[model samples]
Target: MNSFLSTSTARDLSLIFSGQGQQRPQLESILFEITIETSTCETAFADIQYVSWMQGEEEILITIGAIVRIDS
Candidate 1:
């Protein structure tokens, strides 16, 4: 028989804009950097069991899971 073990974590991040004027190119850059950094850590783990992303009007959601194989 074969089996798999998995673990996952999720976090929601928000960048509040007080007004339309708050929108700026730099803000987008920062958000992009954050997304990249969050995903990079997964590469070091074994196979990624699952991953998902959801975008909201004001926040971004990320879910990541990792799996490891056990020998019996």
Candidate 2:
């Protein structure tokens, strides 16, 4: 089944993290910088920033059902 991936238009959003909690330090973290280019008519995703409750997040709502691959 598909899922909703909450993403942001802000390039600087902290998507992942690494820190010390256990006796050993946590492993390094990675972030996938996804660049999405779509026509204005595309409906796979929607810009909900204005209506979003978390206005500061600059969120973009994506429908995973329409997503086939990361390379697209």
Candidate 3:
């Protein structure tokens, strides 16, 4: 009797929105509004920056810093 074992290949896939040519101005506005609304009661800061290439490739970087109060 001959026995055979089959192995399966696994892959992880991710879907991302592609930037066509330039950064959308509405994106910046939306982010700013959301950050401001969430920071009303808390001392928080949100910083956003983006870099775009000539080939319509871009990356968005966001940094958020906040302080919380804890009582014991």
Best by TM-score: 2
Model 3 earns a TM-score of: 0.17
TM-score of each: 0.16, 0.58, 0.17
Q: Give the range where candidate 1 is weakest over 10 consecutive residues by summed lDDT.
A: 6-15
Q: Which parts of model 2 have CA positions greater than 4 angstroms off?
A: 15-28, 40-43, 66-72
Which residues of candidate 1, in runs, are more than 4 Å off?
11-45, 49-72
Clashing pairs in 1: none
Residue range 3-38, candidate 2, lDDT tens digits = 676778775554422222334445555455556667
Tens digits of per-residue lDDT, candidate 3, 1-72, equal 232221111111101222334468665221111223454645323232132232132222223343334333
- State each model's CA lDDT, in order: 0.33, 0.63, 0.28
